[model samples]
Target: MNFFEQQDRARRNSGRLLILMVLAVLSLITLTSLALGVVWQLFGQSHSSLWLASDGAIGLLPSWRLVGVVSLAVIAVVLLGSVYKSLQLSRGGQAVAERLGGRLINLAPQSLEEQRLLNVVEEMALASGTPVPPVYVLDDAGINAFAAGLTPQDAVIGITRGAISLLSREELQGVIAHEFSHIFHGDMRLNTRLVAVLHGILLLGLIGGFLLRGSSRASSRSSRNNSAAAIIAVGGTLWLLGYAGTFFGSLIKAAVSRQREFLADASAVQFTRNPQGIAGALQKIGGNLYGSQLRAGHAAEFSHMYFAAGISRALDGMLATHPPLDERIRRVTPEWDGRYPHVASLSLVPADASADQRAVAQGWDQALAAGFSPASATAAIASIGEPSAAHLQQAHQLLDELHPALRQAAHHGSGAQALLYGLLLAPVAGLREQQMQLLQPLLNADLMSHLQALEQPLRQLPGNQRLTLLDLAMPALKQLGTEQAATLCAVMARLIRADGKVELLEWTLLRIVERNLAPSRRLSGHFHLLELADEVQVLLSFLARAGSILPEQAQAALAQAAVELPYTGLNLLPAAQCDLKALEAALKRLNQLQPLQKPRLLKAMARCIEHDGRIEVAEAELLRAVADLLDCPLPPLLNTTSAAQVG
Candidate 1:
């Protein structure tokens, strides 16, 4: 399945999860209410005579009001707990990582292992045209990893110390790709929901346990046998019901999680196109003593989010979030002999780091990318969430090609901000001076000097490569405090408008900067293509104008895109109506297009970009920006050649 199809499936799975949660809650309510009713009958009404009345018959039924009250209270508690947790995690994956006892690795990492890990992650992110996520390492001996967030913008990758120390660079890449697959396929959001839903179910047990403990202490003080016994009975029953509900919740999580693990493993193979890389990682995990287990107390809470089962508890065979290691290995490498490798800690520096760089540089000349042209719309749609070996190699080469100063700058906070300022400086001397003057007061002496020192190289950089620079800078930019990020956005906006016209690239860069500060949340996509005529018109109109100089040429482009749009009364919107401001608002509305509808719209946009018979640097940037703002990942691979064409 493509990203859209996978997303649709995730949505369906979420629906299934909701149904299961409702059923579990209903079961708890019934069982808890029934238990409480019996307890109430034995105490409030008849005491010793409740089980068998004085006449030797059973006591009266507990009042319906009591059952109703108990049920309502349970519902309230469950809903409150679920909502609270969902909101807590809504802050994004950073919160989840912190809770797992993860320490964020700085951009300028302290060791070879961390540097290697970050390199692999950056290459993957650029190749896939996804934002480079900040990575964190857990100080644990477990061989495991995970990707967590509601969307790619806020996603973070996490790996354990043992995995980083033990696995080869290739194997580590495989594992990281597996987690990226989760991000691409919409599983991160689903997994986050699972954590929240299960937390609610688990909360009931916590509340019950607290009540039971409090009641026991109260009973000790009261020295009243009858009242204490009744209170203890109620508390104990609630605890049992809550625990039973949590048991079912675990079952739900295991069922949903296991199937997705298989999909992710398969996707990792497709991403790297080397089954052995990931299979080898799995083999080592099996042979290692700690395996994939984590010592974190909350491991069980987020087990379903892990790349492997994070907890090895009793009944793990039934409750484990991941499939057995042997099964996973066999699936990835069908010819496996069913023997796991004997794992041992390896050198921190990868064997081929230097050799790989030389290989990428040499291989680039032979790549088919030099003669590349934009593919058809369907082909473009197929490339979404899928990156090939060639793309990976090119990503490697791109990193290698970056100026050392530029590359190093992107790895730190102030340096990254300086890079952004340097990229925004206009080529025209007057406008550039205007921008520099505008920046002089807002920026510190250090930041101003940094940008000025780096100006020539950044300005000399090709337009196609600027986005790659932005991708590299995102992780550090995300490290900015709220006030700092806000200040940067304000500065970026002034910089973009200082020239009296918003260049498409400038507008795009500013939008991207703002998004990285606080990534936009995705819509559930209930709206369809037919429902978004005005928004479609605005998009096609802007795209048409972006690629063509002539009115007739723009019209042709608009018509080509509109052919795929399948709507009535569509027109090439006036340039005044389709300005950057309007296009920005249009994209927000268009993002609501249904899962199936999104690909259709994206394909139509692809049609517009292809209508001119060629792609340009500015045009490619515009297309990429639209795709990104709409939450669709478009690989930079196709357009690596776009640079050679006009950039």
Candidate 2:
């Protein structure tokens, strides 16, 4: 599905959920209120009251006042507690996104292209007018990445070490762009909501634990009376209910999370205007050693959001949070071969290559960063395009022309050096000597020294830049294609083979290199708010110039889509814009248009009418005029209808 359809669906879903939450709270309150009333009646209507009630002076007792006060206190507590919990859940969502982003920012994959991941994310955010999101690194030796957040202002883009090392710039752009699609079109909000809803469900379990513990302590302090026994029994029941809530909450999280992933993948391709990059990335995942299994502790909770499954060993149809890896590959590759090559058999690089070879690898990396084909250079410049400053703003045009080549290069270039070098050189270098001393007992004397030599320069470089160096060094081993990439990956496996061997940071960096060089991998990129709107404007401008509809009619129709209002507002020339004559001709021509061509045409027209913040009354009238002529109802496009219509 396209972004607009996904966005509309998400918004509708959110509204429905909010309504449900309100109903749930209200129902709870109503039930509680009624129970309180019943309990008061049972206690307040005592024998003394019955005896006095027959008198003319008989009236409601003051006992009801005590019950009323208690009822008000209960209501206040529930409302206040629920509100506080909601806010806490929101903060936790932000925390998850930020924590992940911080790790990615540390990846600094030494390659010029790979280093751009951070910059690209920032650019997208600025373009979209949202705050720049945090970035995180997944230290998996697999080609994958993902974006997660509750909103544009609080989102994160995470990449596997494999992705930074394996995919070229274009492919990386495709991946990042895919994530941005989730960010811009309201998918992030849904993700955040899932986190919150799940948290709310699990809250009971946490409370149950607290209650059970508290009751045990209380029982120790109190006499073994019937009251204590009853309290403990109630606590035990609440604990069981809490666990039940946790089970349902997990299911809910998995269910809602899976569908949006498919939509985000489609959107990523749309945003980058390239299927190959993401498709390539998926292919690498299936072919790689570690695949996409993330080693991070939090992998389970974030599985559904990963570009590929984080910890899954094999794809299971129902349990899967992502589409089957093979299916995902097929969607982009349009080719099928289930076999994947092993990483060790592919390359000739010795885990213990000589000093000279290591230096050569470094040189290759810097050259790759600097090197560029004329065609790609031309493509990058052309991607920017001629700004229609006279017709469209420069900011808008800039947003329209996102290039894939730059994305690929950035993911694998030398420029990434500066970013990584700044973050990790110290901790890594400090540990190197200590590691070397320990490894002396296990390895051949020469192998230990060779590794030690690689460490100093490697440590001298920053995290991202060092990562680029590894990418540069690894290509010699990867050029055998699949086998070579695999072989080089094995060298990485061997290097970390010893006890007290690889530090977390070291392993993370190595995995990053492995993923970058993976044979089947593609890349990804994304756009921000300014970019989205600018592109929308370009589409509208193009449609306004298309024939069959007058500029005014085109403009009106476009405005309807943008405002998400009924077409009745854009008072069109009833017979021309919407009548059978108008539609038949357009539909006939539309069939001749390529996939997405018609949507672009429609979106472009929408742009013209949406120049103002609100849809004009005249625009609404024009739309109705067109709809009436066509004998079509101008209805608010619901989620069910939106998919069919947009598709």
Model number with the top lDDT: 1
Per-residue lDDT tens digits for candidate 1, residues 1-647, read 88889888888888888998999999988888777878877776532223567888776455567768888999998888889998999878998999999877758676667777888999999888888998999987778999999999999999998888888878988999899899988999988988887778778788878878888898888877777777678778877888888888888889888999999999899889899989988998888878888988787888899888888779888788889888999998989998877765443324334423332222222121222356623454676787766567777878887777788899889899999988889988888888999999999998998898888778667666789999999999999999999999988888888878788888888988898787767778788787888889999889988888898988888888877776755677788999988998999999887777788788778778878676666666677778888888887735545334323
Shift in Å, residue 600, candidate 2: 12
State the lDDT of candidate 2 residue by residue for 356-465, as single tens digits. Answer: 12111222221112222222211211111111111112122222222222122223322222222222323454553454554456445544444444444443332223
The worst-scoring run of ten residues by lDDT in candidate 1 lies at: 362-371
lDDT of 1: 0.82
Off by over 4 Å in 1: 45-60, 345-372, 376-378, 639-647
Relative to the true structure, candidate 1 has a C-alpha RMSD (angstroms) of: 3.7
Each candidate structure's TM-score, on Cα atoms with residue i matched to residue i, is 0.93, 0.46
Every model's Cα RMSD, please?
3.7, 20.1
